[model samples]
Target: MTEAPPDRRRAGISILSKLLAMLLGVSLLSALVAGIVGYRNGTDSLRAAAIERMIEVRESRAREIEAYMDSLRHTIILDSRGIAAQAIPELHDAFRELDEEPVPASEQAAVRDYYEQTFVPELEGRQGGEADVGALLPTSDAAWHLQASYTAADPDWDVRLATNDAGDGSAWSAANAKYHDFFRETVEQKGYEDILLLDDEGNVVYSAYKGVDLGTNVLTGPHSGGALQDVFEQAERATSVDTMAISDLERYTPSEGRPTLFAASPVGSGGQASGVLVYQVPMDEIDGIMTSGGAWEKTGLGRTGETYLVGPDHLMRSVSRGLLEDPEEYRDQVVANGTPRETADRQVAVTGSVLLQPVESFAVDESLRGRSGTGVSTDYRGHETLGAWMPLDIPGLQWVLVAELDTSEAFEPVRDFTRNLLISVAVLVLLVSLASLLLAQVFVRPVRHLVSGVREVAAGNLDARVAATSRDEFGELAGAFNEMARSLRTKADLLDEQQGEYERLLHTLMPEAVARRYQDGEETIAESHSDVTVVYAEIVGLDDLTRDMSSDEELETVNLLVRGFDEAAERLGVEKVRTLRSGYLASCGLVVPRVDSARRSVEFVREMQRVVAAFDAQHDAALRLRAGLDTGTVTSGLVGRQNVVYDLWGDAVNLAFSLPRANDRPGVFVSAAVHDRLRDQYSFREAGTVESGTGGSSTGPEPVWELEEDSRG
Candidate 1:
């Protein structure tokens, strides 16, 4: 259809007015959008960088904490293995100042009655029961006049319990005089509060401080269920020298009513445990690490930013910043949290630690449950905070590091940035409107040329260019546009290359199907497959191969073996799942269904054995690969967020892992389930039953089979 021509009489004034309106309208809208977009992009980028730094700091502090913990344990073990523990009888000489004379006849009768009547009943005749000393154990000289605490109300309670201790020269007092310097050095040098050595029978043989239990037996005295008792029991339970018994922080009446921890190792040489070396862990080092780490304000963390640790018990491993910096404020908050007056009073007064304080923060709770993530949440102190938390990788510990900042402080910079951006946008918009009105009249020709160039560029013409016909700002604008187009072309090519690399990396991490599902924004990428076979393989004699190599060389050797396995899995229709330490896991029929997953898995195992054998031959090394295979229905998914991994979970995988370790020889081990399916084409021999070390044994030893596969075939 043809359009009508414009009337000349209605053209001039109307067109100019319309153009002025269009310029102002476009200028205002564009300015608003540009300002908002710029502010959002800058804020997000800055926040991401800040959070990344916070995580780095958290991890750094976590490493320090982990090291400190390891050292504390090592110190306890060193002491346990030292001469002090080896020469238990010689320690008797140090208490020579305490007279061996019998108690006075008048006091002796009362002391005997008190032992039988007062301190004895708290035990209920049970070996592990603890005695309650009513409030705290009193070791004062006057208190000992009754052989225990003597309150005005209980003045006569000890009348039947007159002291054997009043004659002077206390066992504790004299022992302190001889060994106080040594024990004090341990506390000061090693960052421990109190140190205790328990005898084979759980008696407090030696202690750093005399104010607490010194002669009490943990098995049947005031210290039952205490650190010494617990450490002794743990030392007894340990079947090997490599293991030590460690206790989490808890209040102990034996430690003068303060929070303490005990780590015990068996003492005495080459025989049964003689005693336990216990350390009352000090909080100073831990507190210093947590609070001192984030004090650098340059990271945008502001006043409310801090990092701390939480343990499996949902208690703080470090002191709360508020408690250390402002105890009065902390006291008020605990009181407000409905802590009873008496409890609150005792809790705040329990100095030297906030270790056992329960954490009510959702971030800490979530992290303790093994979820690593970042978000906004209400913290333990009831403040809304931005937080990132992750579990530490330290062995024998279930701890998570939490980095947090209060919302008000965290976003203060963002708010300021946005305000400045808005003001700049407003001024720019006004100036641009005025310029647009004037420029619209003079630049119709230049605008036509620019629009034509932009259209050509949009149509994929990299060679499109505008002529600088007039050497003015319009000409400069044209040159800038051309330069931007050139930069765009270069960036697009680089982006394509990067995208390809990422795709390759992603597929290497997970199956292509799983990766696609994950990239499609699926929160949980899980798939269950029936009749899949899992192979757990470990390289043997790795110690011999890398014994003389440096750390980097050893790692390279391991990586070489892993790469070989990945290549074999690729050829055999198996998916490589994960490599943990020396163990490598892979499976068949995971992403794709197959009628013969068991056969493929066995073949893959043989191929892996060949690769390791060849590596041994080529390097003049003695490396070998052993594997265990099991076929069953299995589930697979991503297990972690920060270090996300494609992992498999089920009985088949567990049984396979167990099988490899069960057989001492480097060869293929298969479950009867796998043997039954592959016996038609393979030979096997019975190994033994799978002992699920939790006591109950099933899957009879006869069902496990050793697969004899010849890779040459």
Candidate 2:
């Protein structure tokens, strides 16, 4: 340059440039620190919450399994108890009620007639009634001979007399016939496999299965063969023991198939073992329960989660995967060959604790002992797993029920969530930093122009104005500030003449409290307090009204009605919380407390009734309003962002909505609590107590008091 720069211009450039550089550096540093801290804290909190949620999920699954097993046990015990108590006694009573009394010769003919009519037809394919038919006949009667000749001879004579000894040969035979029929029809009809009468020596005296005869010793039969004899002998020897006899499928497996689950209980009489009632449930059927999906799937358990019953011998008796899968092969390959029976039994006998843990080779050790609960992380088939173990306290068998789940599969969602969260936090922090830096630069430039313009105006330059080059928020702010400065300069000339007009405009636009909040940049919600009743009123004629109007007209009319209702409520110092044109839900008494909420509610109803009456009178149509009221604590506050409005919530609000429908008086209904609150304050006619859907017993109907006001009085 040919000439040197002016000293003043150089000083201004040096000062303003240094100030802008310092501000930008400080802002960037602060943003970096805040963004880093926020991201770290948020990530840590989310991780902790995720872990807590997983723990809750695990505990919930454990509790559900425990409850399910408990329920199963309870149901089975109750079923068995019923069979012992009610069902058995009822069957015995039915036998006693059968007629066995002897009749006189005159009445005997009538008895014969009655027997032929009622009993003969039912015994057609059954036993031939030979022994009792001839003796029960009335020899002098012609009709009795016809009945006696048609009856067949009895097949079972000896067994009849041995069981019961109360009548003549013929009458005894008849009783035995009836008893046999009852046994087959009642017990067998209900799905009992075999009803066998056994001697103390375990000999089958009587059996539903005829192949197994009177002299056959059950102890020698295939049913009680092998190690089962020891179980049977133990049951017979121990008079106090009611333990069930359990057998392994391996012991009874036929060459054709796998072994089945067979159990037997000894029926004791007078402190002695009379017989053993053996029940054989095919392994497939028992496995069906052990693996049903309905029981486990409903509890949020997946197919990979399994429940299996392991016997004292470490053999799997039943397994359920909550899916359709065969467990027999799995049991044979994994359980049967895994552990020795003697070791498992010793562990169970010594500790009496159920075992639950993941195992590699199923080696028995002291590690398997204890009644206390614990979890183990281990490998199963090279896959890491989480196993929950519980002991099943079956009367005669020491068994463990273990539920195992694959850990990776179970916790995959949590892992993925954490990974995604970290990525999201990093991305969001980067975006915010970039956006803030841009905003800072944009705002700083505009602020510089504003500061320069203010200085120029202070120097008596009345025409000075800021140039807002963009239409964004900052640009709008700059334009407004420039307009304000220009107005201020003009106002200096006419300040006294405009003061009254400015004050009037300010008062009309905002109240003093609201204006203060706006000046301080605070968001405020309008609040009111008065001792006035609140009411919730619903219109009942909207369905009919909607049918007569187009959809657009219906919506418009509903909106107008809601506005009208809100206006009426506001005029009475009652806050209108919300309005649903179709359902007609409206609320009041939220902003203030009333001496009696019920009375306030009634007044609200009166006002609504008047409004609706006026509207109906003008239109020549009838309209109905239902109102509910309750007096209690409530909190009212503004809710939502874009379309913000006051809302009320509390038991009072709920009761108000509920009361009108309960009143069912065609106009308004109120609960008893509401009526009691308002009865002295308002002239209400009692419509007596009625059943209400709200506010009553947990299971029983609620009692609601109905009320109507006397308009004339």
Number of the top candidate by lDDT? 1
The TM-score of predicted model 1 comes to 0.50
lDDT of 1 by residue, 1-713 (tens): 79868765843565556777888898888887888789889899877866676677667777888887787667766776665554443344322222233335444445445544544453333223455545234222222332332222132422312222222455544443454466567766776666766666665656554323554566776557765576678787777544568776666654334456667777766766666677777666667777774363554356778777777877777777666566667667766765455544544554322554566777888888888788788776667888888887665567789988887877776778888898899889879878877877765443777989899889988778878787888889898988988887888789889989988998988888888888788867777888989999988888876889999998998888888888999998988888866788999988888889989999898989888888888888888788889888889998787777889988788788888766688899998888888788888888876753223445445357888655222
Off by over 4 Å in 2: 1-199, 203-218, 226-231, 241-265, 277-297, 302-304, 312-315, 322-383, 393-395, 432-620, 624-713
Residue 190 local lDDT, model 2: 34
Q: What lDDT is reached at residue 195 by model 1? A: 70
**Per-model lDDT:** 0.69, 0.48
- lDDT assessment of candidate 1: 0.69
